[model samples]
Target: MRYLPLEEITEDMCLARPIFNGDGRVLLSNGVKLSKNYVSRLKEMGYQNLYVYRVGEEISDFSTPISDQTMREAIHGVKDAFGKAAQRQQLNIRDVNEIVSYILDEILTNPNVLYNLMDIKNHDNYYYHHSVNVCIISTLIAKEMGLAREKVKDLTTGALLHDLGMVCVDPRILSQPRKLTEDEMATVREHTNYGFQLLRSERNLSILVAHTAYQHHERMDGSGYPKGLVGEDIHLFGRIVAVADSYETMTSGRVYRKAMWSHEAIRQLRESAPEKYDPDVVAAMERSIAFYPVGSVVVLNTHEEAVVVDVNAKKITIQFSSGPRVNALMDLEPDSEIKIEERLS
Candidate 1:
């Protein structure tokens, strides 16, 4: 299967994976042959990419960090909880905890897998999807940093609701396709305080979890918002979440800006670390994510095009867009001279 942009997808391509709605229902099942109408409708629905099988290619399951069913359920839970919170109702803490536990369990079951952020995105459910992505990334980072199991669970929970304050902000500002004014930007930044208050008010939740919402925007050099606490002043959970949150947000598409590629997003994070983000937390994140996810098309230093087949082994299948195509598998080891020059998509 190949991951291609929606604009690049053509008619008669078989969908390699299922497309689910915001409510966890399958909108298009796997192996469905896409027609002109299917592609146009998907684009109209704001889908950016699709996983399609190539000609004569065998269908194989493309695994995610967590299963699609679990991801859909988590997103649904987040949407439900945030909608209730937006209505000034108390958040269902038990439901939120269960969602976090399920995500943690899935990650813990295979802690060594490099997380691939391949989930499809839609503008309508951006916040909910972003929340779940942050939670999964934060959980992986926490485990890689060797946090206690219980602490990992707490971090996962906090990461899941880090953006709860967004519900209090004006939706017009968030969905607008233009730059925000100074006042509007300030209003957006206030979500930290708003989320902190909401989370802190829950008696059954830990104060540290609330801090994750409050301090995730705080920078290592005291340049962040809500509060300008310097390094070590921010709680460990906050620091961990700060990195995860930034990575997830940068790699996700928004109404105002296009999404950054995973490798470029990681580069920005690494470049800003020790000043804008925690160096140790960034390091942990670097180890947990796959810079080049499976099914990604990349250019080799030798000027050949190939598709990534296995992220763990850095294995790729050589192919081309034109001329005689060759199918060969090669591992890109650390010591190997053959290196990935750039990601095409």
Candidate 2:
């Protein structure tokens, strides 16, 4: 099913997925037909559309964002904890360790949870969710980079708070749809410095993490903002967060464009601007993400339909229950047997 904007809402639109209140009461279950009330409640809650199957290919004129209820709850819990931490007027070392440990535990036990969050782009909860996504990606990248456990936890906290400066920026700039002019983007760039300042303001905050806010956007070629530190000059926490943040932002749906299908996003990253991003970090991210997520449907080269089963670092894994498998890899033999037609955007 595709998502449809509220402006085009109609009774014919069947609920392709579950619709529920923030409290978890089901307003409509999967397969339930849409009605005026269902649409109204969605609008009331600030949602602009519903996911529905159209004539043939799934389509959504409305920006139907992927939702992970568990992630939302986790972010809320983290937000509240931080609120408490702020009111207490100090970040206790033990408490900070506990928070990082919990985040690491979640990542270690449920890796897919992190990948799923990478797909969601809730405008209402960007900061908390982006923090969670960054932590997951940074920790994974750190592990791949061979950092030790203690170092991993420290870097993870830094990744989680990398965007903490956005809290100080004008909300209008953050949410603007049209591309920012140079002047606005310059202010946007200050998020790194602002984030550094915010964390520095807290006497008890972790200085390493605070620095991540400053250095996360720095590039190896010294093209990044706030500081143009290159290569070894940049902090490890900053470097890790840079890769994670870009991947998360690219995959998340935006008001201006439908989210790039995972495969396409990965392709772009792999090609790289060279000299800008570290080649090693790019490799790590490619291995860790599923460009074509499982449960997503795509057209196959065989001129038939299929659901994506898995996404590997080198090539997407598909299960062709109905036909022969295609050679999606080898350049000597690019799959004539089957090809993914397109992602259900």
Best by lDDT: 1
lDDT of 2 by residue, 139-186 (tens): 777766777777787687777667766756677998886678898888
**How do the residues 147-173 of candidate 1 rate in per-residue lDDT, one tens digit apiece?**
877888878988999999999999998
C-alpha lDDT values of all predictions: 0.82, 0.61
| TM, every model | 0.92, 0.72
Using alpha carbons, what is the TM-score of model 1? Answer: 0.92
Model 1 CA lDDT for position 94 = 90
Instruction: State how far residue 5 of model 2 sits from its true place (Å).
Output: 8.2
lDDT for 324 (candidate 2): 55
Candidate 2 root-mean-square deviation in Å: 6.6
Clash count for each candidate, listed in order shown: 0, 4
Model 2 error, position 191 (Å): 1.3
Question: What does candidate 2 score on TM?
Answer: 0.72
Candidate 1's C-alpha runs over 4 A off are 313-325
